[model samples]
Target: MIPANFTYHKASSVQDAIALSQKLGEEAKYMSGGHSLLPMMKLRFATPEHIIDISKIDGLSYIKEEGEILRIGALTTQSEMEYNTLLRRDYPIFMDAIKLTADPSVRNAGTIGGNIAHGDAANDQPALMLAMRATIIAEGTEGQKVIPIDDFFHGFYMTALEPSDVLVEIQLPKKKKGSGGAYHKVERKVGDYATAGVAVHVVLDDSGICQEIGIGLTNVSAAPMRLDRGEAVLKGKKITDDLIAQVGTIASEDSEPTSDLRGSEAYKRSILNTITQRMIRLAIERAQH
Candidate 1:
């Protein structure tokens, strides 16, 4: 199927993109990598009258650490993150997720911003962002605002982004000395959407007490889910076999999966529980060394 007739506009910058979107009103949509929007448009699930192409906009692709934050530009492709030395050295969780995100071709064109902005539970990045406790930077007519990851996903195919706002960057805290994270998902085949997935980030003190933790679940709910109950169970305590088991049960209980091609709800919950426990242990092992 082909996308319906639509006018195309190329944006020279973030400001230009926002201006075009505002001027074109609600029927206009901003597209960067087009991986997310194009397919929806082709399916007629999204039939915008105008597409403000922001792919050519400069200064929106890079990964760097500044002061206490690791800043990633919105347009940085998944491939960039996949091969980045810094990410490999300090953030193996990203590598785990990226390796499992579609194929090399999709990773080459898919931008991190689009992954999050699309607000699809099946996309790999959102849960990673949630576990990393990342922040989103959005630019609009009124200027930029920093949105916490927890507040960014409002519902299915929805986000905190206004129609006229362009997501500009993602910010994460610099990796601390004792911090580590890992992500894992159960899929039917290569590049398939997760039947269930888990991303875990943990900071362990020298004596092995868990200082901080974040647990995020994917494709098990209406939106990406942060396992708050599971995190609370482990944070500020010594990670133990018993506690890990408890958190696993909590994760399965808290997820809201529905029966589908992926699996039955019960099956997904079981996978979620198993991966949740596994990732927490992996994160802790990495943190210890």
Candidate 2:
């Protein structure tokens, strides 16, 4: 099916994009990579009157570490992240997820910002962002606002982004000593959405006590889920096999997956439980290195 008729506007800059969005109001949609918006438009699920193309906007496609933060520009593609030396050395969890996201061609054009801004739990990056405790930067006519990852997703296909706001960057704490993260998902086939996915980030002290932990679940709820209960059980304590098992159980119980083509709710819960333990163990091992 073809998308509904829409006027196209190419944004020369971020400010231009915001201005166009504000002028068009709710009738305009910003197009970055177009991977997310285009599909919806084709399905007639979204029929905006105007498309403000921001894909050509410069200065929104880099990955770098500045001071205590690792900053990724909004327009950076999944392929860019997959091959980045900085990401590979410091944040393998990204690699874990990116390699599983769609195929190489899709990854080449899919932007990280679009993935999160789409507010789809099936998309891979949101859960990774949640586990990293990342920050989202958005720019509007008023200026920029920093949004915490936990506060970003409100419900299905919804986010904290205002109609006139353009997501500009994502920020994560720089990889520190003794910190590591990993992502794992159970999918039916290559490039498929997860039946259940888990992303785990951990900071372990020299003596093996867990200093910090974050657990984020994907495709198991209306919104991406952060396992605060599971994190609480492991944080500030020496991580044990028993505690890891307990966290897994907590994840299975806390996730809210529904029955669908992916699998039954009970089946997804079981996968979540097993992967939660596996990812936590992998994160710990990496942290100990």
Which 10 successive residues of model 2 have the least lDDT summed?
A: 203-212
Give the per-residue Cα lDDT of candidate 1 at 138. Answer: 98
Query: Mind giving the per-residue lDDT tens digits that candidate 1 earns over 76-107?
Result: 99999999999999989999999998889988
RMSD of each: 0.8, 0.8
Worst window of 10 by summed lDDT in candidate 1: 280-289
Instruction: Compute the lDDT for candidate 2.
Output: 0.93
lDDT of 2 by residue, 13-36 (tens): 999999899888899999988888
Each model's C-alpha lDDT?
0.93, 0.93
TM-score of 2: 0.98
- How displaced is residue 159 in candidate 2, in Å? 0.8
lDDT of 1: 0.93
